[model samples]
Target: MTKFVVVEGRTLKQAMKIISAIVERYNTIPILSHAKITHRAEGLRITGTDLDIEAHIDLDVVDGGGGDWSVCIGVQALAGIARAAGVMDVRIERADNAMEARISVGDGAAFYELQILPEDDFPEIGGKQGDLIEMFTNGMLTATLDKVSGSISTEETRYYLNGVCWHITKQDRRFVATDGHRLSLCTYTPEGGEPASRIIPRKTVKIISNHLANQNLKIYDVDTGKLDIVAPGITIRTKLIDGTYPDYSRVLPSRHDFTLDLKRDEIIAAIDQATATGGQRGAAIKFSNQNGRAVIERRSGDFGNAKVKTSTPWPAGKVEPQPFAFNSRYLRDVAAGCQGAIEMRMTEPGAPFSIFDEDKTMTRVLMPMRA
Candidate 1:
């Protein structure tokens, strides 16, 4: 029996783009590089997973003559074929032996054979989704993640800190990320009451951020130790990191004795000029308050040195210049996302300070380095 499925080239191309996020480019397990295609009475569903994260997309098939049989096909191969197939429709047919499949592009003008893996070999991560947790628009989730993603830790040792912590407070729901030296917090109202906090891994955060753009999303069944996100024509399932997040509240400073307001563009340009000097790893940039004006300086023995000053008002009652130092790169990261006026609050040269927007809805905490 020859099993087959026919999908439009354009539709298959879009589905492949979403699946590519979960498909591993290099894998020891061959099945990890392939996408599972299942034909149903209603439509055709395509799924891809790397064991940690899985993505699914459902599309209406042009032809349903292909009997229902789940088969694995190389994601990259199919995507490449679709891209080159121009704007023509596509047809795929399974071999009688179930070992290979044929892809026909543009009324059989081009044809290629793709090797297949048994559907039974693909690991299944599906389960009965639990109770409804919370629902929010995709814009809200993307905005919150954008504010904190820069602070997510990339170090593998501290696996617990490598993702955003999603939790609910008495006031609102919050998304927080930190890498020990810096932290970011973003809050928004929740659709329902508080639910159990889950640490969404960094990779999943990125995938969700990409897919949720301009789409509405719902999060449910969090109690099952997995995060389920459903959007139009898309479903994502990812396992939550099993660990406790640190006490982030304690890290926020209670008092800031000195405050300076500066234009976001001016400050970013100064840092860019300083970083252009190319100093040692984690080089320091000196920020000194001199007579109500802010001075930025960077000294690199290997590359060179640069200094720029901006007219930023200093806190009152301070006669002597107060100087502080911070990692040049970290300061740049915080400044890149900010707009309009940015407020800097600090206590001393050694204390951690905060950089935030005028509204204070989003803030970043950075630890200073010795000059």
Candidate 2:
């Protein structure tokens, strides 16, 4: 290892980028768990990759040599120093089997030593091609992802819906996901971009939503059947799903003979009551429109049951009481944003039903079980 000049003034922002990039690939390989620092004439290139996803940043050094040198350090310590250390000087040194980083901020200075791994073991993730689409920064990207992300399936069997499906039509780019029980779909038009269809894996979409939420970023479609999301100094290449997604639009209820209009929270609380007595499977909720008030009742085989009577602002057509059983867990997922007002449309007790929020931008369809 060769000796190098220390950094006198490096912003917290630059240190954060280097730490994030290193940690991102730490778990990919044993060597990746260690940070690699290289010095060149241009600057210092801090890079990390797990062979699947990669992140790198080039920071200007105060004074450095022309030859490249590799020294591995613990990822956790680097991240901690980057977060805790304020503005000051940093002295990095390479020893026999370890690397030490001395961070100085204000009048306090702390030194940490981390075990080293061979630089050759660090993996590099090669870029691949998929489809790319550009989206403007605003509420459209974040809102769409937040509204639909929860509905993605955690089950490994139904692999198709495990991630959000990027369905692009001529007019709009849509995202759809389902867990075999309920489905959620959100759509937005690209401010200025091409239209293409792809399936973005679950984890990739989540990381992107967190980093790029409400921030403008370029979405690159790789030809290798992967989605490349670039936000600021972060880039995420998520593998695309090759399986066919279910025809979700067809699952939506077309027409309903009965519509129950009530507040989202009101119905959610009623469902919670039913869950307490009904066991994990869920209790039965009976809907009846008598006079003007809509009556909802729940009965539990084990625990005691309760009834919730709530009035609707809209007119309720005369209909017989419908006895239906639904998994309360499913109801909660659909009613998450139903704070203001919600509408439920159904044709029969055992038929599929649709629930809508106030804006109607999103709708959840729940299949009913026979009582």
Candidate 3:
């Protein structure tokens, strides 16, 4: 008997959006590029995985009573078909041979046939093997990832550093990422009790951010190399990076000689203007305090030089101005992470400086670059 399902195009699109981040465009294992669709009594479950990370979402469908059938179809093809569907409802039916599936828009307005792989060939990506850690709102998880994700190292050689370090200290829950030259740390209070620490891979971090952007979520089986994230109608199983994260506490500065506060928007505008002059191989921007004003300047041989100055609040002391140079891109990253005013605490010209949010929950450390 042929299996078939009638579903709403909008519903399919929503499920695809949640799983698409985990779908790999190209994979040695052909089924890895496809999403497994299973019909259940409750609803239709759509799942995508790349071996290391798996994401699934349960969607309500117009039950055709397909009698519990599972099949794998190309994610891109399925998404494309859904997007092109002109009507609200789309009908999907498997061929008599069970090797292909046909999708048709309302009353044959549009038709598409997609090849399918055997459901038995699909890999099973399991959930957490440990214990439930804690439950937190989706907003909290999203906010924490946004603050530290920018500093995640892209260098594969330092595999452990390629993800965000999630741990709980005596004071608060911490999310940290670093690329040797710069580090970002975001902290929040734990809900109930502390959870075990884990190094979340960059890919998994991105997937969680996309899926749980604004929902409540629960963490399970943390620190066991696998994590289970449970949210409304969705669950994500991701493998943590199997390595130890660096001791980030040693890098945070204990003291600074001067603190300069600049308007977040104004400093970001200045940095944007100054960095635009940077050519293909962009140069560093010089940050210096002039009297009671902050100035940012950058010069590129291929392009031209630019300078922007903004008034800043300086402490009431004989403040000695020191010039500090930093990568334009790094400075911009820190600036973008801040909400209100940007605070910079520096010890000397070449030493690392700290940038923090107004509430000080998020802190970024940046090493100086020679100008």
The C-alpha local distance difference test score for the whole of candidate 3 amounts to 0.81
Q: Rank the candidates by TM-score, best first.
A: 1, 3, 2
In model 2, the number of clashes is 9
1-371, model 1: which lDDT tens digit per residue? Answer: 55667778888888888899878899999999999988877788999998888888998787856567777899899889878876788877777765988889888899998899998899867676777666767477777787899899999999999899997766677889999988998765534355557899999999877767767778877446797888888888889888999988887888888777878888888888777756575689898776668888888777877788887876676544378888888888888878778888887667789878864567678888887
Regions of model 1 farther than 4 Å from truth? 190-192, 318-321
Which pairs of residues collide in model 3?
Answer: 138-215, 138-216
The candidate with the higher TM-score, 2 or 3, is: 3
lDDT agreement with native, every candidate: 0.82, 0.64, 0.81
Model 2: lDDT of residue 284:
48
Compared with the true structure, what per-residue lDDT tens digits does model 3 show for residues 220-302? 88445888888888888888898989888887888988888878888878888887755854369887666767788887777
After superposition, the stretches of candidate 3 with alpha carbons farther than 4 Å from their true spots are 127-130, 190-195, 280-282, 289-292, 313-321
Instruction: Tell me the tens digit of each residue's lDDT in model 2 across 138-205.
Output: 63566677778888999998887778887887666777878877777766553323545677777666
